[model samples]
Target: MTVINVNESNFKQQVLDADVPVLVDFWAEWCGPCRAMAPVLEDYANDHAGKVVIAKLNVDENPNLAGQYRITSIPALKLFSKGEVAAEVIGARPKAQLEKDLAGHVA
Candidate 1:
């Protein structure tokens, strides 16, 4: 599946109201790491398809949502389950490591 582009308007429905867990990548176009993680996120979204929802929220475009989540950095990854944040990963990392870090939440 393709990664969803999340914004303030659809944030609630796409992530909060999702039946399955949601992995949200808080990113910005200007961030190098955020750009680097784009393909990784795409691959992960495809692999996890129905199991989890992968989304991208551009911080530059949605500062309110980013501030609400207390995102202090770009490429911040948050795993949300049951409408709440289950885990968070700051900065970019390898897919294996990212999966390992979110193993419990996704499983």
Candidate 2:
């Protein structure tokens, strides 16, 4: 599964109302780390298909949503479970580390 592009229009339904845990990557086009993490996120989307929903919200385009989440940095990954944030990962990291960090939440 490819990472879904989320925006203000679909944030509620895609993340908040999702049946599975959702990992929302709050990023912007100009963020170098965000760009670097793109492939890592894609791999997780494909590897963890059906178990978790991976989505990306461009901070530049979804300022309101970013503000609501209090996202102070780019490439911020927030895991949502049962309509609320369950865990968060900031900055870029190796795929292995990311998976390890999210192990408890995703499982």
Candidate 3:
């Protein structure tokens, strides 16, 4: 529920300028894997709370942002810290696996 829906207009302020780490989910509406990853990200956002921020960007709606990040795939997770990408994750994954993948940055 805490996941903020980001678009080209606010991407800079929301993700790039965030005080805490921001996990931006680059996904599309028709992508099956992206849909599957939604709840996992939501759970992560809720659990992490103030430690990190979760943002969802629809590639279909904001192709500019997707292209800017070189998102060739759906469900691409880019962790932004201090205005730069700190980590990246691709494809759909279980919550535990996603957590493990981001452990270093999230912790």
lDDT of 1 at 55: 89
Q: TM-score per candidate, in order? A: 0.95, 0.97, 0.96
After superposition, candidate 1 runs with Cα above 4 Å error: none
TM-score of 1: 0.95
lDDT of 3 by residue, 7-62 (tens): 98999999988999999999988899999998899899988989899899999999
Pairs of colliding residues, candidate 2: none
Output the worst ten-in-a-row residue range by lDDT, candidate 2: 1-10
lDDT assessment of candidate 3:
0.92
Model 1 per-residue lDDT tens digits across residues 64-93: 999999999879999999899999999998
The per-residue C-alpha lDDT of model 3 at residue 20 equals 95
Number of the candidate with higher lDDT, 2 or 3: 2
Best TM-score among the predictions, by candidate number: 2
Assess each prediction's global lDDT (C-alpha) against the native: 0.90, 0.93, 0.92
* Candidate with maximal lDDT: 2
Q: How does candidate 3 fare on TM-score?
A: 0.96
